[model samples]
Target: MDLKLQKFLESTDFIRAVKVTVAAATPVILFSYLNLFSIGFTVALGALFTFSSDIPGNLRHRVNGMLASNLIATGSTVVISLATINPWIFYPVLISLVFFLSMIAVYGQRATLVSFSGLLAMSLSFSHSYTGWALLQHAGLMISGGLFYLCISMIFYYIRPYRYAELRMAECIVLTSKYLKLRGTLWDIRADRNKITEELLSLQIELNETHEKLRETLIKNRTKGGSSNQNRRLLIAHIELVEILELAMATSFDHNKLHHTFQEHPYVLNAYKHLAYNLAALLNELGQSIENRKKYTGKHRPFQDLEAFRKAIDRYEKQTHTSGRPTADEVLVLINMFNYVEKQAEKIKVVEYTFTHALHTQEPKHKDKELEKLLTPVHYNPITITQNLSFSSTIFRHSLRLTLTVLAGFLIGNILPIQNTYWILLTIVVIMRPGYGLTKQRSVHRTIGTLAGGIIAFGIISVVHNSTVLGILAMTCMVLGFSFIQRNYSIGATFITLYVIFVYGMLTPDIQDVILFRIADTLIGTALAFTANHFLWPSWEFLSLPTFLENSIKATRDYIREISVFYNRKGEVPLPYRIARKHAFIEIGNLMASFQRMTQEPKSRQKQLGQYYALVVLNHTLLTSAASMGSFIQSRKTTKASEAFNAITGAIINNLENAMELLKEEKQNIPVDKETKEMLKLRFTELKEIRKKEILESGGTQNENFRLKMEEGQLIIEHLIGLTNLSENIVKAVKDIRERQ
Candidate 1:
């Protein structure tokens, strides 16, 4: 088998797809018995509705978005049909609805846009031919079809809740392990930065999607019994593991200067390899645990093994200290890494405890505080809602653009004495978008898709005409083709275009130049979309990206401070700790995305360019250090050491606060106290020495050992350098800006 096929087979995602497909078809199949026409309309409407929910953002957002889009589409269709009589008034109303609906469809609620758009199209298409009662009847039939589909999906969800959760968890674990392994090899890959960046971004996206899938399953199984509870715990554990894995990857990259040393040191390299393997094994075990939760009614054995692994990890840390005289910084790094792994292990332990209790008890005990601390919030801020509404607002702007473009196309077609004005309108509606890039991409795909679709449609009509059976078969093929297209943008569009052409051909038996007309209309629509997106109060991506990066940087600084404070107190940080962590992670993600967008923009903004680069570097450094610190805090076994570490953290927090304020205010700040500096210098130096000794003991070469020591030494120098530069630059920048103001 080809690689693609192998991957597809391995994914087992097809199983879920099959389940969804069946659920979707069920409503149509059932409704077909009641009314074929209703079934046909409902299936099309359902297909369109499916688009409304297939967004790539947070689940909560997608759900809310779907609801909003549906309301707009259905409500608009009903209101417009009843509210107006004159074709001129009705046409403008339709156009207005399309504009608003399209804007929402593109920017705000991506998942539901198609259904909303379809609702407008459907109302316009049938209203003139059908009267008030008939239109209401059709609407009722469509709604019933949708509800039926949703019910079937709900039934499937409940039947094997654990199955989806387990599958998702397993996939997440596997992908995370692969990502970690890739991290170790990244320095040696020699790939272009863009390629590497894309790979890393893709990995992030995959991990996020996995988290979403697992979260959805966990929510569904919240009230389910022992097995479900156990699975949820496992999912939580998996999430922590993934987070750590991501941190590890980022840490490795930040310290890429030590790549050769890391590669040469048997122990360091072995640790990394072991970490990946162990994580992979743990993930596998978790998958099995979920699978066998029902079969084995006893306490989870993996938790016991997990505890042992934690102890073994602790021993490894001690061995590093014993084998060589590591520097203070190296020691800190090692300690942090050990702590992070242990915390992950501890999470698994807690999960096990919760699951075991849940299995034996009638009512599962609430561990709200514990779970709350574990999970991070992933919600849009209410304060930013109005500002962020730009995304939705753009949708409205684009819709108007499309409507104008369509009107122009219709007029031009009529002026040119074309027989089919509807053809021009259809083309305009399909092709027109709000922006240049999107318009270009859509046009290319639509044209390709239409050409292919038209050919296929023609062939089908020629092969199977006059028979209802053939017509049904053709429709089924079209639906399936559209489904396939849903998986890939380029391919899906082609199939959909073909499907549309074929359906039109079947509906109207002899139209010789219909396909040709479609191609022309698509091109015209594409042109209109491009024109509108570029000229209509064009929103430049560069503006959005910089602001986003700035916000992310601020969020990261806050997160660092929060974590430091939490460590200093040596107690559970409130919800804000988790919230900060989540926000920071998301911010970094946004920063990365912004950086990508910035690259696409014209580079005339030199000041912005410098700031962007500096911000990216700073963000990367912050993420690496934060991960190291987090790991150290979680891994410390001794109470005294923990307390000492906490004290050290307190001092760091004081310094960080002063530094951040200084940076913000652009003030010539007082340097940290001599005592604090001395302490930091001593700790970092000692940590470096410890790490060097470990490298030598691990049978690393003199060059490798020397490089490792230098790397550690360099980090201390870099840290100091960063602090001084940041403080100075902030003071200058803020002063300059204030003076100008």
Candidate 2:
């Protein structure tokens, strides 16, 4: 098989699309052959709704979610079908159901999906005026379809239980390789640092998302029962990926300073860049090997590059010696850079051996109840829904907007002489999201995609008259449409439009009218959704950015505090430290995503743009630097936390706390103590002197072990000083944003 195609086939999304297509289309096709097309179509709808609730998770959650969706969707179909008898009854019932169902999203992601299934059923219920027994028959068929889909899902899980988790891990590994490559490119002398930095930040958000998905898939299963060998291997891979990311972040240095220091010798910097790129390539190859279920046997050895880089550094020192050049600090910086590369290479070696040899690195196992805390907690309590009843809650506001917009769409469809009025409601439901930026984006995509699809569908109908070909085309579109719906909405919408048009074309002789109606109803729906989002309590990103920023800073603080605790007590990294690190990454990713969404919104709605941008960059640096320090401590044997280390970490945490307080509108300037600042400076000076003495004592031929120990001490001091400076800057940046507010 072609590698790309093989990867796609192995993906969880493709598998899901296949399951959905089979579940939905099989019933319709079979029943239609039996001249029971109506029942078949009803069953198809039921299956699709239940499929929507089959989100990624453990077996129990997956089964329970689909079952709940089956019940909810069936109830919705029945209630809406019965109420459609009277306009007065239908409008009130529809409005109340929309509000209640949409508000359930406050419960969590899984609940949101289950709620979406209910709303979808309600929307489709408007398509026909089925009364009494007809409604009961439809509901029954829907349950049958849902049950059919549930059975298929369980069978697939039984056949390949680790498939989803494995794919998720593969994705994270591949993304981490890309991340390493981007981080490596920062060493390029001619690279566009700003653009690369933005890409790195964007990639961080994606990695965080994938990490959460892995947690949902792997952690949930491990918690459920005794984990199988396959599950344990995947869990270990995920843990390594997380730590590898930290190693990548930790390996980063002050590029500006590096560039300035190497201004006269760009070749040395190029050597570093080359080694970094080689490391990335090695990692990428390993990821591919994992994805392909093959052993990675070092097709391209980065160890060679590491050796070459070491040689290059030796030559540079030899040349600089005659020129009376390269000060002591510069030599120390070189050692630091070399140490970073060597450390990363060593870590990658460990990962490779573990993967290829199937070595089970000891991983801590949590009990079911304790492991649940690792996944994003969902509150099933009714109070969670009731608390979001206020307008201040984004979910509540979104629910209200959806209800009112859907009601208006229904009314407009009724007033207009339109066929398939449910299309309008479907459009409204599909286009409107909780946030203005996404809603606006979807409205545009939906409008363009519908028109484009209609034009193409018209041409296809005009040119082709074969029923077999049309059926094939529609089926193909269904598969592609389902595959892209979550991955790429615009492309999904286009294919879905084609699927709809082709299906309806077979039923009606007036294909042109069908096309026109689809286009018109879509336009109406998009307009209503866009208008409602803008004018009806729209959730803007800018207004929420401050809260995100505060959360990011707070999480960063907690993460650093964990490192501080570890500094005094070094051992294997504990679960609390990993949890804190995970939360920090998540919060920073959220802040970055919020800023990105704000950028997409109208300029009038974007506030303090430059300041927000600065904060994003600063927060990223703060987290990365802290990770550098933390990872270094974890990976190596380091001295106990001296008073200087304690003072510096305390200052960093204090700055972070003050930043949060400032975001909360509490103004206070808490500078690093003058004595503590001197302490850091004094420590750095002392390290340089100690390094000088070590070189002299060993007659400039110190054993590698002794040299590494000296370098580690110098590196620790450097990281401490840099972190102290960064944390103080974060304080100033927050104060500046506060003043603007």
Candidate 3:
């Protein structure tokens, strides 16, 4: 194969784009042939529109954009067609209307808004030439086309639900595996920071997208009942597992950074590699189960004793090298890696249990309580009105801002005393955003794109004035070209400008001056949008950032406490740890987005950067502590001295709960003090002594049962100590950071 072909084949993005193009265009083609009005242009335009909720960082924007565009298009088409009389007046009016609509589309929440604007622009512009009845016919036709497209999309969604589910599951597994591999490699050597950052970002993006699609699937599956419910529960569990795994990965990153000097430790490297392989295997199996839409029955087999594997590796490393204190980096990495492995194991165990329970159960309502308990711990709440409202409010505010700006532009156009200047007002209404900041960023790109596009369109018209065939071909090429460049804002804008100019210019050659006026109209829309966003309904990043950071800290603390209790009691750690991990991920995600938005605010540069980096460091610390706690738990023997260990574990949990409460209250500074620290130390020491005495007493009894119990008890005690140490440190860190603020 040629290099170009090889490159194309290698690009999954390109493949996905092709799939979307075919899927979107196919319906338009079918409808057009069925005498559903000329959908040729609409099909091409829709195909060029690649915004989907399935893409991370783009969903909220796209959805909001779509709603705004739809409203503008529907409103503009109805009002403009009814009022406009002559073509001379209507032509400029329509162009001005579209120009403004384009601005709103750009400034609004999503790319869908742009599509709506395109539809309105096309309908209103074309309808200007139509008589009264013909205009109504055209409106009906356009509405039908829109409905058909939506129906097709929904149908496709249902028909291939499993494929999407499987794909999401597979992607999650791939990410977890990559994270494990990266951690292991980091243990062997100091890893490239840029590469690691890129990988982490990519995983974040992929996970967000997967999560959206999963939500959609769950919604669709709800009406199907029974098996669908089972699938939904499993999918939710899968998502939780991925979230926990991510926290563990973050821990690994922190460990590697803190323990850079110990990257080459043989024992650390061995343990990480072994743990990575096990996690990868487990993820692969889970993915397969999802793909097959079957229960994960493999868990019934004898579980792999990760602790024994770690011990063996440790023994081998110790035998080969003289004992010495590990460098700070090595210790950090080792502890982090061990912690991650432990969490991963716990996640798998919970998921396995959930699947097993579902498989054996017969009654649906009877299983609800059990299912609720399992899911509550994983942060898998079914979608609710409140959640929807919160998400919608963000978009609604942005859209309303844009709408006001558009209204302002229309008022300005009316005052200019230009023929069909009402179109300019419509244009303004369509183009303006809710805030000044977004408008400013979008205007710069839009202007450049429009200018370049206008020049190209003029050239095409001058070169092929009489050749309709060539004009249509140019349009087709532009559509495909724009689709390819849509990922880049400047490129997308340039192509869109060129495409729109060509379409409008083809309809009126005599008014070449309209291009200059259209540019003015766009500027007006941009100005309105920017002003509205900055002055009206302005969102402060600080409003959400503190809460997000605080919640994340609390979640981290909760996770530590749960793991500690689980180790000490030799009982199942309730679902809260998993839930806490999910909440923490969500909080981190919110913090990142809040910071990104804040960076756009004037006088926010230093604050945003400082806060963001601080949050990052905090997250890193939390992950490291969690991972270390995991390893500490796994290394201890617990069965024999279970009672003593349990008591200590209970005390630790109580303290952790208190610490979490204080942290939540922003009073984390109510210090542990010397007395508290000494008390904890004394209790831990007593627990250890009790375990030792039990071991000594059991030594003469060849009874395997007594020996096993002693070992179990010892492990439990060690695990509890690790958990308490981690919780205390994290609480202290949170307190320190809060006090500094």
Candidate 4:
């Protein structure tokens, strides 16, 4: 069996989805208790709607998000149902509700979900007629039904307060281990660094996301006073795992240096590569063990070659001395590489020891004294609604567009020969989006998904006459659909379509007509959505590329400044630097995502995209090297290297900023300053002289700082080279664009 397949089956989502499936059907199955059987249908509707908002997060945030959705559902169902009693009032009120809901989308994705769920419920409620006390009763029933699901949510929260957090931590461990394997591949001279870097950048983005989640979850489970935490063991283990990854994955190495030494003496690194593989296997084993709350069953002899690799490098230095003049920098490079792998092995042992003991101890001997310093969970606040409330805002335009398109769809549904008019409304709400790229992509998927689902549902309806069996199938489809919505949209849409079709088929039994009408409704809704997407204040990703790129440049600037500050202060890292690093990562991730969406869009819209892509790739490379050195710089003592670092960093930053400004102005042919280039070279030469004298006279077992400074100098040199290359390309990208223009 494939290991990936095994992991997927064991995921927390798979388990939760199975639970949701049972929960969805439980209400309907238990409806046989009372003589009134039809109430089960309404209860099922309430459950399905509530389940739509059951997104993953910390337990408290998850419950709050759902509760907010429930409140919206209750209020919207009652108000929208009452308003629809008069057509004159219904059209304006419904349109206004959709417009306002769409405007709230600027708050964020979750806020968007809560608002859109209300819109969906309101639209569906309009299909039935209710007035006065009957309308209030219908709203009351829906609220009561939603309350039942809320009860389930409460149980879900208490049963496993930290399940999602631990699952994410497990995923982080697994991905980092896999990334280590990818890095091991880079040891081969024939490896494609470009391809590997792309994969690494993607994984880094995912790791960032998981780190963000862990930060939030840790805050939630933290107790106020000096009591033992429910999650202390896991939290401590997670921090250990993070440090292990920093040593394993983010510790910067001179690739050329390694390659150069490897070409001369391959035996030196043979054990190092094997150690990496050993750690990969062990980390993955640890991940699986953590997920299952069991001991690590895998075995490996880690750091077995620590002595051998050291001896091999020692032998190389002696050989170099006999054959020619052996430079201190060169020998130190070999020793540094040797020490890196050794430290990795050591870190792995620490992780292994932590997991083995931290999780099993009856009472923790020590507590997380620094737990107060951890960042709190980021929750959605309504402050954003007030910040950007103008007509100029994208959210307002999207809301206005969504409202107009919905009104048109509603009018057509009333005129057309369709049994389920609300399906059209639901389709539009589901498929249409604020941006052309997203809406067009969703339009294609939704149409394809509906056709495929309608056909399967048609076949099932043709043969499955027993309503109970159909209900079971529909409930199964619904759960699977909801599960895949976050994982895979097209697959989720297919199952969701089938669920909706089956639900309606039990009432409107003409299978052929039902399928035909669904296809027609989907096409109509998709067409209208695409039309509105194109003609409205349609935001294209291409138009937004320059803005995101500019922001990326700004983030890079702040990050470099933070690096300077870290090296300058040579103490505990400031909180502002951490915040800046986060912003840098987030902006780059946004740029990468935007570039990806641009690729998916039509070709004509992607002018200069290739050049922009080159710039993005270069920026990502610089950050990757920067990411490697962020923590390393903090741990180093202030030395003579800091002065040269200060001297050279300014020119590079100035050149990079100038390039950014040139790109923003859409100009070309920015020349590199002769003084900057000369200064860069002169400073590196000075550092080499400072290092060569120290290394030439130093005995073999000196202060660890001596070895650290050697590694740190090399790291700074490599990053400077990267910064020079990327800074040039950032300018050249704009030059390329100018040529095309």
What Cα-based lDDT does every candidate model obtain?
0.52, 0.84, 0.52, 0.72
The candidate that wins on TM-score is 2
Question: Any residue pairs clashing in model 4, and if so which?
Answer: none
Q: Residue-wise lDDT of candidate 1 within 1-741, one digit each (tens)?
A: 664564443333444344345545555556566767445555546434543343433334444554444445455556566545566686677666655555445333353354445544433443244358876765665455445444544465457545555556656656665665455455443646555545665566567656655654454344233334456565555556545654564354344544443343435534544554555455445444443333324333444544554555455446656778454445445444454455554554453344345544332446533443434444435443344345445554555566666557656776875655555565556555544445556667767776776676667667666645544654555555545644655566665566556555655756447766766666665666566666765555554554555566566567666755665556654557656665666666666665655564445522355555555555555555665444444443212223334444455445445544543435544454788657765765565565566555665333544444444344433443343344335434433433433
TM-score of model 1 relative to the true fold? 0.70
CA lDDT of 607 in candidate 4? Answer: 77
Scored by lDDT, model 4 comes in at 0.72
Error of 2 at 597 (Å): 0.3
TM-scores for all predictions:
0.70, 0.92, 0.64, 0.88
Candidates ranked by lDDT: 2, 4, 1, 3
Report the lDDT tens digits of candidate 2 across residue range 189-223.
67898899899999999999999988888877787
Predictions: Cα RMSD each: 7.9, 3.0, 8.7, 3.8
Task: List candidate 1 stretches off by more than 4 Å.
Answer: 1-51, 54-71, 82-84, 102-129, 162-167, 187-198, 216-227, 230-234, 246-250, 253-365, 369-439, 459-476, 598-614, 637-741
Stretches of model 2 off by over 4 angstroms after superposition = 86-88, 259-268, 292-297, 315-327, 360-373, 666-709
User: By TM-score, highest first, what's the ranking?
Assistant: 2, 4, 1, 3
Clashing residue pairs in candidate 2 (N, C-alpha, C atoms within 3 angstroms) = none
Model 3, 1-741: lDDT tens per residue? Answer: 664455433333443454444545565457656865255544433333322322322223333443444445445665566546664675465555544444333332344345445533544353244447776665555444344344444455456535555555556655665665555555444568656654564465456545545544443344224445466555556656565555454443444554554445445455556666666666666665654456665632213556754675455446434555433233323443455566667776666566556554344545444434332121214342134334234444554454455446555766875434444544444344433445566667766766776677667767766645544544554544445553555566676566556656655775356566666766665566556666767655554555655566556656656666556555443556555555555555554555556667677423545645555455544554564454445444434334445455555555545555654554555645577567667877887777577657774334666545544454445456655665565455545556655
RMSD of 2: 3.0
Pitting candidate 2 against candidate 3, the one with the higher lDDT is 2
Residue 565's C-alpha lDDT in candidate 3?
A: 58
